[model samples]
Target: MWRTQKTLLAALMAASFTILTALDFCQSTECQSYDNVPLNAEMSTQTVTSRWKNVSVSNTVQDMDYFRVSCKKLLEVFPVDVVDGNFVRTVKNCIFSKSIPTPLKAPLRLVAVSKDVIEGVLDLDLSVTQSDHFLHFASGGKLPPGSVPLAHRYGGHQFGYWAGQLGDGRAHLLGQYTNRKGETWELQLKGSGKTPYSRSGDGRAVLRSSVREFLCSEAMHFLGIPTSRAASLIISEEQVWRDQFYNGSVKKERGAVVLRLAKSWFRIGSLEILTQSEEINLLRKLLNFIIKEHFSFISSDDPDRYLVFFSTVVNKTAELIALWMSVGFAHGVCNTDNFSLLSITIDYGPFGFMESYNPKFIPNTSDDEGRYSIGAQASVGLFNLEKLLQALGPVLTKKQQHQAKMELEAYNIIYQMRVHQLFRAKLGLLGEEDDDAYCIAFLLKMMEETQSDFTMTFRQLSEVSPKQLHNRDFSQMWALADVSSHDLFPKWIHVYQHRLRRQMNDSDLERQQRMKNVNPRYVLRNWMAESAIRKAENNDFSEVELLHRILSFPFVTQETAEEAGYAARPPQWAQELKVSCSS
Candidate 1:
């Protein structure tokens, strides 16, 4: 009996330590609340409009004085490659290459800017973004005063095959900025021209893809998902040619650049290159730097720190993928290089939000085999984690390697648990029931059979009353109307109603409010992005600006979004829209 009691106490201590470690990580990063918005739903329309003006433009615009100061923490702390020129060749023994951005041609246009990101994250006055100095700096025409631009070197497995030395071809890490909040953000320029990683291809991003990345980056943030943020999108008259579908029909499109920010750009591939090249010493140095900077909760002196870091990454990666599933988002390219080591969503390309509830939905036209579909993301996540474990093999002992594998084996359980928790919150289920998982599965199956819209079906359920659901009155809820057409929907509704009755303390209004907070009314649908992109290509950024503002508060319903048909059924032309890996 004493032995069993002692074992139980040891388990309790381990669990407590895990909780404290998570708390420490959160404190270190200063976690951003997903629910906070600039506008309040309870306010009158006039008041909301008045408050939006104040919130968006609260700070005065200033000159470019703030651009004089920049930090080089990565350069100061690590060794760079000996090769200094922007030549295409294999690089070794470096975390980054010193590459200068080839400036975009003149006649640059500032298309879109995230005012909230400027004011909140950068702690800069919004007016500072108005000058041509901001445009030039963002587009690589002129570097910030103290910026030391560099390109990250990494490798990844594309689809299922190992693609070696797939580093930053067109991106240049400008410098790091530490804001008033003491949060450090690494700023990078996408489409800032070529580096050593550019292999026979132009190192520029076209306007078509740049607009999508900009809008979706901000949209994902407002949805409460952990993601890289976009500060500005600038377009230029420089021509870029692409065979968008590899069909030999090349076309000329204008170049564009986006200034994006993230805590760290390191991914599983960052270590993969070092391991594959047998750079064990450099790998160890990079690993220690990551732990010291990001994973401070794990002591640098601990011999088992690598194992602990692997475990933390495994748990957070699972949670991040679960959040993606909850929102019906498919990363499209789930390659190891694109998966962030910090567990935030990064490298937005060919991504799509599921319109119809098909688990087989493939967003990237380049994915002919449907390897990175919506339903396959969780499994692909496991595959990437396995690759990550392999990358850490050189540094880990035999016993630690086994422990890391054991931690990886728990990924599916962790992912499913987070998914269940998030879906429960979406359905406003206060307490547990034996049938909760079954209920969620049942509704998804029905949605699949009926081809119901994924985002709106859950959103309509939140807006609907129990009486409406029972009476089958879905006249006003088009998404629910599509769902209710299924004969089994009645059976599912009965099960859901019975489940709701189990909530003792939650009133209908409280339940509705809870559900509404999680179920967003709008997501960046490909069609919506296409519409905005068409106008953006013609130098009409009105739609792009409007979409950004509306998506800033995705949970709250707005009159402009309604009038613009953002919540309506997608147009027929949208079915022909295709996104590939061209850009």
Candidate 2:
């Protein structure tokens, strides 16, 4: 018995050592190194599913028949320009995963891949992959030279007024694939080289802009805003032509890379551009494909198909801008081309959240005139939606077009309601109401006057009781805070507190959770931008890696991390940093 006991203890000690060693290995290099990892390992891949590819991979006009075909495979796909360095390799498969669960033929099917335009389709075989894309930059190998897949066929509005021709100027849609869970998705290569859309331009994405996009996309996802996901970021060692240098050089050249992900890279501009031309047949085909690919739930027989589509897009854009307004997010370029045809958020150019709630925070260095200002996004969104109607006029009947125009006109009201609701939520108020707009305008006025920090002020608004509100000496806010008839805010707060009381059971805690989830503690703060730019310029992705980690759980506080500098606003230098849409 004594001998057996001693032997058991020895074995237990040995097992403990083995486990510790393995954990360290996963934590150290294996988790971070992308190239060295075994691609075939079950632990490395993720299950992908979706109906986006249920249609067809070939650009054939199969109508809805393309929806029935299924594919599953992973082939080692390389880049279009090998010499210039766009080598983002992955297995491409066609599976589209959106809001709905797609009907799939096989559970997990991995196959061979070969394509010229798309590098390759990858089979993600792991049960779970990293949600945040930073894992790749953190531990992965050298980033491939990226090229914007020349998907320039689409068109949309600009600043809610101008209808500009825009396409994937610095973005590439790699291919679609199924992950371990049988989900399908599109993996696009952004910042990859230029396509026909280049139009006398260099197709490249700078590391600074790429990092902002990579971090912000995940941050928005956490905030419950519908947004595109970032899969992997591969920056090249080579520089390209850029008017504004990443390191403050006024030169027209710099090194850049490609960002890969999945989504409808086809912007609203794509549809608008094609419609502007005489491609009537192609326009009809695209409309059919869109319904099958994205809005399948709606049928052709529906009397209000166009209206329904318009309304759906309007509400989505409305909610999207409202969320941005509440968060102080300025999309820098709210141009129709920048707006997703499908109403999803993409293109993080000169994007910034408000440090000061002035409503005119313009982050895009190129947006000199403040056309896409923070306060103006809602109206701008309405402008873009109106263009969608004008573009559809060529296809829809005069009567149908009239109806569509009416629907488009309603965007302003719908957006107003959403914007008001967001303000109430930020102020810890209850549901929608008629007087909501007044309360909102009051808050905005106060914020503007007090020079409140857009994010921090709203996150702290619930702390303001009438007594607290008074003590703060916000006499200016009181002028606007009062309701038209009922001493507005004091009465509203009375009701708000009562509502807050009912939620006291557990909703109080739940409220905090919900608000926090909606409000990210750390954004890719402008200062962090400089840090990411410097590291990326040096081909060091440590800063990028750290930024991804913080952005991954953007709602959670990460004080102890080395990128702790994220907590502060940009120093004087970040102000001098300017970015154009061309970059």
Candidate 3:
């Protein structure tokens, strides 16, 4: 019996040592060197579900009817000039390779699909048998014919300093496809895989970030904000390790890839890289290409077309920023690289909707200095435009350069005008009065001081009756404000009532309805996203689907109490969430 016990103890000790060694190996630098792993050929043969049988790999290019893929127009329009060789080089040797579909780990499970986008923009019948195949294609698998996947070359100012040669590191532009309406849309795969521009990082996005982006993109679009739209979200069986908090704590996370649909993936950084490299001809070529592709409304034959393009961009960007402010959105990282040339909200990283009306709120924990704070977004928009103007200096004459400066100067005025327009609509103020601007300013200031729930305050105000002003019990809107704020609220309400009285053309019911239309009943709060993400992580996607449906019609009030719970104040734990660049 003694001999048997000794033998068992020895064996147990040996097994313990083996387990520790394996764990050490996984954590070691040598074992974690997956950044440069070559693509596995066998991965291409991996099969998806039988529902996606129609989306098969085609031997003949003509058979690839999943998407109406077109040839590389951007490349064709601009040949391999001196700038092409020195400045805009191919991302990888795979640029010329005919088979460019980066293999995703299977089994590929579809987490979400935008049916509205499919029927509307894609012009595909959602009830048809081929719809499943189209959705499969949208999941980052089965390349369309004539697909030319290439990583765009660009650079930008990251955090107020020049960051050189930063392009689409993990993103691949799979050419452009023309919709049924003859409008072209670019389909890009994010978190597909690594490229030459990936640097030392493993070009993979975790499921956490992918889910956030997929939902937020569509959410912004539904909110009437100019933003990129998500076609589909696909998750893999593979596990990836990520340090989500940027701290030492590392955990294995599921991998995902999101298919992002956009008008164009061009950024302000695209021109910046060319200008900084002194590639003047290439800069002009890119500018001309952009005008031809996106800004075709502006005549390219005119000599001052570039100037007009710059001014148009400025106007759009100002309006975009105003919309963001009106909706209480804080884009955590407002880096120049993230600024879209078309003035749409492109990248959704570490973004947060303002819970409390605090202008100083910074969503990104990594942003120690509130550079991209809610209050600073307007100024940052101007700063990014200034950087763009610098990039366009080579193509513009001295007077044109001065004109660009003047356009940049006009951003503030344009931004204020748009903000005032939106606020006036939200407040149901018709025909702006002399004190209209002051009244809006005073309300915002009070909101900031009282730390009121930004979205709920406006939404609740839509239901408040003019008769409720006299009764304390009916003054439920004032509950959002502090004690000091409550004391000053009556004076503000008196002014507001006077303004409403001036708008006698519309009845009180009409005024309330107008306000309700402008102010959304629900916004994508952090807690709501967290709840959906938690359930998705557990392989239960019901909540994600629920939120998707609810957010699609943000202005509509839900009939059920359970559904209305989403519009309530966030829980305590959710208020402490630390979303960063990793998220």
Candidate 4:
């Protein structure tokens, strides 16, 4: 592996440095850098003709001026023969003619002819067009017809237990590249149709789920979390089959293809499942590749390379979980496939940020068991990383693996510590020790008792006076709190207040910025998304615009009451708007 690294570095750095000479990149639209070399250029050329025009552009991420999409690369990825007939574009569209602000919006011009697979992105905007779908069908796009690039694999626990066989099903990674900022990034397409792992399924993504993944990923990035960002989202209205719980009766399948952009779609489960194969060595090879691609900062010769990898990943997972707690996010389906090595929120299926503070709340309507509820996510993340460690254990010496296990085991401690620190910071407190943990748990208990607002609880606490802490309403909720028998919670708040008084920062604005960043004034409230969904379904994009605007500046205070709707919890009716499978 070290020799492989040394041999790969020259070629990799060379490609990566050339403003992104992506290694083995194949798709022309996404894999423009040298690393990306398309296999089906002959078929791609046929999808394009002089008639393709720009359709709808993105709305949320209004930053469209920064990109230079590669059209020639797009030609190489899909088919060239069907270009004239179906109009080559770069996505398998599920959304009709809707506009949502995309994070990296460039003109998404396309050739709009309905076909089996039309996916193309010319040197322009990252918007969706009909032609991309045609290319998917034209190039024998059910699965690319060659030895496909290996799944960037890793191991992770599923539902607190470890089984194997987790690889990309509806996902096919395009490649990785360095952007203009010298930032190394991954570019992979979700719903790029099926792959070898489709496992008797239609391997398509729906637009509804696609939009959620796309927007939420970018939002996490903007919020200073280690999150996968959506570069583009394309929707083709062609009917695809997926399961729908019918009329409170017949539960059957329906379908759609929603193309998504991600930095890296590689998952921990991808590694573990492969371990059960004769291809364990292949798993090792993939691990080496991951080390090279994402963990290049670590020195391979360092006796603690494996330990350091585990530590870095563990810390990242902790921080990510803490951030989710701050904003009240629940990754509805946090199975191995969605547990990216990068630890970013990858799949956005049935995902939601909390409005009211219900620690046990599960966002995925399909998750009857609450496996991915918000309260359990931290534990789940730790469990997943442990599974990863189990897979990587053999790669290092037994001694190294033991050391790695200790480092990984500390994830919960670091996570709880950070989470407590955030809660303190939200209250303008500058310090606390393990006492912080007690207070955090108590606060959660209070939130649950009052059916209190998660964001509002923190927000209002920013200005909480000593007198305010003893409010009759607060007292009633505190009484209902079913937290542990320890009186440590109420005791800690008193200690925290005095601590804050002594260490009050020099600048209120500085304190304000710190608190605001941690505690968002707006989240992607379930009610808000549903409101937008209802209106958007009827051809209205206004609610969508409003929700997008607030989420973009999640930490900001709205200037108007109308804009303040994002802060409210979902009403009972809104809560009942069930989302089964995405799309």
Clashes (backbone N, CA, C under 3 Å), per candidate, total 1, 60, 0, 69
Q: Which stretches of candidate 4 lie over 4 Å from their true place?
A: 1-157, 160-164, 245-259, 433-435, 463-497, 504-510, 581-583
Which model, 1 or 2, shows the larger TM-score? Answer: 1
Candidate-wise lDDT, in order: 0.83, 0.51, 0.71, 0.51
The CA lDDT at 21 in model 3 is 5
lDDT of 2 at 397: 78
Q: What is the lDDT of candidate 3?
A: 0.71
lDDT of 4 by residue, 150-217 (tens): 22323345555554443455554433333322343434556654544444555566545555665566
Who wins the lDDT comparison? 1
Error of 2 at 155 (Å): 3.4
Per-residue lDDT of model 2, residues 389-460, tens digit only = 766667787788777777766665565556555655665555544444544555455556655556655544
Candidate 3 per-residue lDDT, tens place, 112-185, comes to 86767766665555443134344345544545545546666778988788998777767777667664345678
Candidate 4 is scored at a TM of 0.69
Model 3 TM: 0.84
TM-score (all chains, Cα) for each model: 0.90, 0.68, 0.84, 0.69
TM-score pick, better of 2 and 3: 3
